[model samples]
Target: MGLWLSCVALSSADVRISVTNGAAACPCLGPAKHTPYTTMRRMTTRSTSGRPRIAVVGTGGTIAGAGNAADGAPSAAYTSAVTGADALIAGVPALARLADVQAEQLLQIDSADFTDAQLLLLARRVVALCVRDDVDGVVITHGTDTMEESAYFLHLTAHSAKPIVLTGAMRPGTALAADGPANLLHAVAVAAHPSSVGRGALVVMNEEVHSARDVAKVHAMRLDAFASPHGPLGLVVEGVPRWYRAVTRPHTTTSEFDIAAIDALPLVGVVTSHGNMRREIYDAWVAAGARAIVHAGFGGGTVPEYLKPVLAELCAAGVPIVRCSRVGAGPVIRNASFDDDAAGSVAADDQNPPRARLLAALALTRSQGVGEMQRIFNRY
Candidate 1:
């Protein structure tokens, strides 16, 4: 009898058990072994000191948006950035089980209206949070339209290895089958995970995790809107994150770009090269004081035959021009057929035009040399 009771205790301890809402009881241990289940319940309801401290910063995107319909039908016409960060956090009760979560509202606007000033402020705030000893990780709720841009911006400037994850939703919070709560919960899980350290900035959406540099909002209205042209880093399954690969490029603490020293970024514009494009558009940008231009060239970053001379003139006048592809995916090889090596022009390598413009602006802040700019593109 003694041997049998000892075996029962050992076997019950070894078996994984989950008791939800005090409804399910362990069959082996009875009332005497209920202490472990009670402990687990306490752990889930409140975070202990051992839990990772995660700060959730909300910038007001579709995830927090609400609709006006009395029936609570999801509507894209609703105002964005309407919900506060605390409410967003409260909406996801599962997140409380993963980390010690706190939230703060940063801004509330449609991402299409996001400006450079707002980007700068957001980066500074992220840097501040990452440096704190009390905070283990940070997550930003953002609009998907420009989420990639903001993520990449933080990837380049944030000087910490602590995880920074960005997430958003296509439908409003009031919509049926809203993805915001799930995305937010997964983002918090990723941010609190130990493996996420040194991964630079990340985008978590629709169960997939992507590096900031490669992730983009490819679809307009689908739940699976974000994807990386290269491939995602990993995915979240059953509230646990699994990473498949690591980012190779220099980022965070390894990056030379620092947000602390930069008060204002230089003006950079993207111009699409098309059939029969005129020179006045190029000249007008220069006249408006654009320090650099990212030419979204056709098919492998080729400048239109007509605009080549104008671009060369702009380069000679100390306005750096970067050649990037409008083809969406693929690298823009340097010294291509249309490249003017003598004019100090540089290629954007694999970066898209919008990202190229951001890099050009940051590179210009450090140096205007063509070689230095090219090196920045290659390294970052």
Candidate 2:
């Protein structure tokens, strides 16, 4: 688990671990043998006891799932969110060596059932905890289904530089080789690490660290399910976090959005485009009180020729539209395949449909202008 520091060449933008008073320091691997950047940054211990104080906020998922199998065997059929946060921490006793951990049960429900109100509550709770003097960082245990969306929302809304990490498991906690304990431990370790500060909200799964804005769930049942299209920011090996890169996008303290100011998230609906698409579906969303619409377009966010006028009509009626790609990877370039300018629509940039809808909802809470919304999508 030790990094080959002897072969690494240091550089200006490079980061190094500085373990003080025999305390463990967050470590990372350098690019080459002696990486060369003129400036160097060191991560040091914060607490007097040399252990960072970490808060574990739990929103139950498969990590807390329990199975009803005879003879205590793992089974596919199980009940989700059957356990609490304290139990999860107790299951991973090794976390005590990493940080002074505390657990709080925020919610017990499936990620698929997570509502906008619940997301708001969680974000507010996390931001509130981040400002406390006793807490150094926070780790969230969430369901894999909508973890990325929730994490991204926090990334844009959290006002602190303190580390906020989200983690979950692909298998139920009652399974034979449940991943919850290890994932929770790594999440705590990453949250406690000083190097994780200022990185914005992160998702730690399969022992890998990913920026909240980029990571997505690609597989349904595999242990290694979460992945980032822009690639993972770093990795956690044997409870040690090794970072490879940093997020360039505006996030956390740099974000303009604030959790305190947001009273309620506006309704932003998503409509995925497909062959022989129907206009009624799009119309229904708008009629159902959707303030903004995110069209999950096909290939470069292209709109069907027939539905163009319908969308253009809606845009003219004062509703903003966002063109986002339905594909798994790549950016949805503005005015590439679709005439976003003429239709008064904004491109989702690199964000997927659901994420685009989230950003759109958040952006609408502040402004509804096409240009400003487009800029928000671009910058964030």
What local distance difference test score does each model get? 0.81, 0.83
Give the C-alpha lDDT of model 1.
0.81
| Candidate with maximal lDDT | 2
- Model 2, residue 177: C-alpha shift (Å): 0.9
TM-score of each prediction: 0.87, 0.89
The sequence of per-residue lDDT tens digits that candidate 2 reaches over residues 214-311 is 98999989888999897898888656677887889999899999999999999888998889888898789888999989999898888888999988
Weakest ten-residue segment in model 1 by summed lDDT: 1-10
Model 1 clashing-pair count: 0
Off by over 4 Å in 2: 1-48, 71-74
Model 2 gets an lDDT of 0.83
Flag regions of model 1 displaced more than 4 Å: 1-47, 71-74
